[model samples]
Target: MADKEIAQDDQRVAVVTGGSSGIGEATARALAGDGWYVIVAARRVDRLEKIAAEIGGGAVRLDVTDDDSVAEFAARIDRVDLLVNNAGGAKGLDPVKEADLEDWQWMYETNVLGTLRVTLALRDKLVASEGLIVNMASVAALNPYAGGAGYNAAKFGLRAMTRVQRIEEATEGTNIRVTEIDPGRVKTDFSLVRFKGDRDKADAVYEGHLNLGPEDIAEAVRWVASLPAHVNIDRIHIMPRDQV
Candidate 1:
């Protein structure tokens, strides 16, 4: 058997969930720039198409909740050198006490299960390619916020899931690397989505300060994926300097 080590010199394809927007979009661009044949996947086909066109990669319309969608998306690609599980967010900001149970459920569906669905479905390919996984968690996962209970819980679950997956895969001789990135307060569709696209409300969230941008997290993903083989980064926590 070849060494159970991944040298940093491997060049392989990448699959990024949530590739249509925000950090997902930025990661696709960065990976492509680094010579990966990136496959950008998400629920938004038009945006995915535009990004695929721009980056010279393929696009798949994927709903992480749908098993068929995940399977079909994986079919088009033989193997993935890397998987960026970046599909996540809070649909609303209601406190757990006042929060709609459905919102919390939806958050888990995407932030936790959505990532698992894709990663599990493509585990073999990742193993075959000796690739890596980057699950996009949130700082809220570590430092919960006042109204961030539902969102935070989902990310916390994801972080734990990432750790466990890494353990099992490594022991199984998959030689796959799994890492979670927890970024705080990024300026993207996050606030807009949380507030259901109320511009003023979303704008106010980042008004007084410069929140992190999509590219900031994207650059982090690039760096993590570019490390020499045998280097398995476990967690990355990045936030704007002003953010606590």
Candidate 2:
């Protein structure tokens, strides 16, 4: 019996979730330029298809919060050298006392659980490639602010999860490298989403502040993934020079 042939066009493959826009889309393009056979996945198929076409990568419609959708997406890929778990967002900005429990649940489901689901599904393929996992966290993971309870909790959980995953993989003698990228503030749809599509509210967050761009974060991702196998960057915190 012959082994099944995997149709691989590049030596390394990277799966970027939430690749329809912002950092995810930028990362997909950057990685593709760096010679990775990139696969972009997200719930927005139309946008994903456009990005995929532009980058010469494949697109898979994926809702990271859905176990069945994630499973199907994983099955379609036979190789994974890098998995960028970037499919996450913030919900509302109400203080804890006035917070919506449903909003918190949504944040947890998308940020933490969604990352876990996709990583677990691709664990084997990553192991096979001695690959790297980049979990896109945020400064909110480290700092708690008024009206940011839900996002803070979710990202903090992700930070803990990424650290534990690093330790466990090391203990198990797997060469998989885990990195948590905590960006201070990026000019993206993050605020828009958190404000429930209120562009005025969203625009105000970065109005007077110099914030990092999606391309800046994407550059960090590319550099980390391009490093030699022996050098594992445990975590990276990026901020615009004026952020501090």
Candidate 3:
């Protein structure tokens, strides 16, 4: 279906950033299955198009870190009942003393500022719709482990932002719901990207351990979005059985 067609319909509209793969892709599929008009936004047009096609939704190119890109992406959407901020990721696993400044910069830009840019660009639409904003965070936000300095800081910032957003929206009478999903060790391309395409290293992170898949987090998002507008889920800390 065309973007305009979906906008004209009465179905609730949802925008999923980083919808090309992993949890984002799964969330798009899940929401579409539940009758939402899903718009899958990501830099990889090919992958986004494929998911959109499969889900009978729309696809738009989005680089959350770029101001112009975010503006353009937000301009194409007429309505949004749900906004999934899922574009963030970890960069490196170095200690604070040995931290890679470049890695930290990337992590902050993508995980922290990227969400900020996208949320700000779409803030008006969200307010108009009285929408829900679901920020995909990690357990690192709550529990900092060694060699996770950059990721911990980035997610911690996200957690803070999510809390403030909830408060601001509530106080302003926007009726917008905000939720933060902190997953523990979801098995996806997360480690691969963090390890810079090291297959062996990526494989080792979840090997021999019970790990949550992208679907698990997707289910959490679906459930959160499914709730009544008056019922807000403050935060969800999801973990695999063996993790803790």
Candidate 4:
């Protein structure tokens, strides 16, 4: 909502997709800590419920790839001051020469299409509330990876999607603004997921230096949302101190 219209509990009623773990979990907790009533959604209902309990928010099971599920979840959200379109990942980090088609499809569906699904589902509420969307993009969206062909493609598509959506919002005269948070090398279950739960392999992602913690990003999200309505943070690129 506008700066003058933002109520005390306005930020509380938000939907955080991919809220089961990592950055999503931390963002939910951070918002709850700020006294915003949050709704955590993800495929892992059990985990989502746990996060809700910890943060005193609500929970919903959502597979961003499924339109029906996303629509139902959107319907369940009564008031959304913010939508953290954070459900995404990197899959099949292989060179194009040996890449499997399934990997490309999964990445596109989850990373790119998933963001689109949730955004469309919540578009009305956002326009009504003049809310903002924080998309969890990665530095990968701006950098090409040797073995990250599929992942990069999906992220690049997602980046384009965010830009286009912003333009559409302007043309549609919607008050809603969009921000993309691109973090470089984060330490979370992300690496584990990328490595198919291989602890040793995942551990190597942050072996040399300290990586961005989930809460660090959670705080960044909070700051962006807390800004005055007139000052929209177009995008934020966050990297760990050691990364540079």
Q: Best candidate per TM-score, number?
A: 3
* TM-score, every prediction: 0.93, 0.96, 0.97, 0.93
Local distance difference test values of all predictions, in order: 0.87, 0.92, 0.93, 0.84
- TM-score comparison, 2 vs 4, better candidate: 2
Q: Best by lDDT, which number? A: 3
- Evaluated at residue 19, the lDDT of candidate 1 is 94
Deviation of model 4 at 107, angstroms = 0.9
* Rank list by lDDT: 3, 2, 1, 4
Candidate 2 lDDT, 110-215, residue by residue in tens: 9999999999999999999899999999999999999999999999999999999999999998999999999998999989999999999999999988888999
Candidate 4 Cα errors over 4 Å, as ranges = 1-11
The collision pairs in model 3 are: none
Query: Model 3, range 54-84, lDDT digits (tens) per residue?
Result: 9999999999989999888887888889999
* Stretches > 4 Å off in candidate 2: 1-7
Model 1 ranges off by over 4 Å: 1-11
Error of 1 at 142 (Å): 0.3
Writing each residue's lDDT as its tens digit, candidate 4 over 1-244 gives 1121122444547789899999999999888887788888899989998888887788888999888888777777667789998899876567899998987898899998999889888788788889899998888899987998888888889899888888888788788888888988888888787778888988988898978899999999999888888767877889988875
CA deviation > 4 Å runs, candidate 3: 1-5
* Pairs that collide, model 2: none
Ranking by TM-score: 3, 2, 1, 4
Model 2, residue 159: displacement in angstroms? 0.3
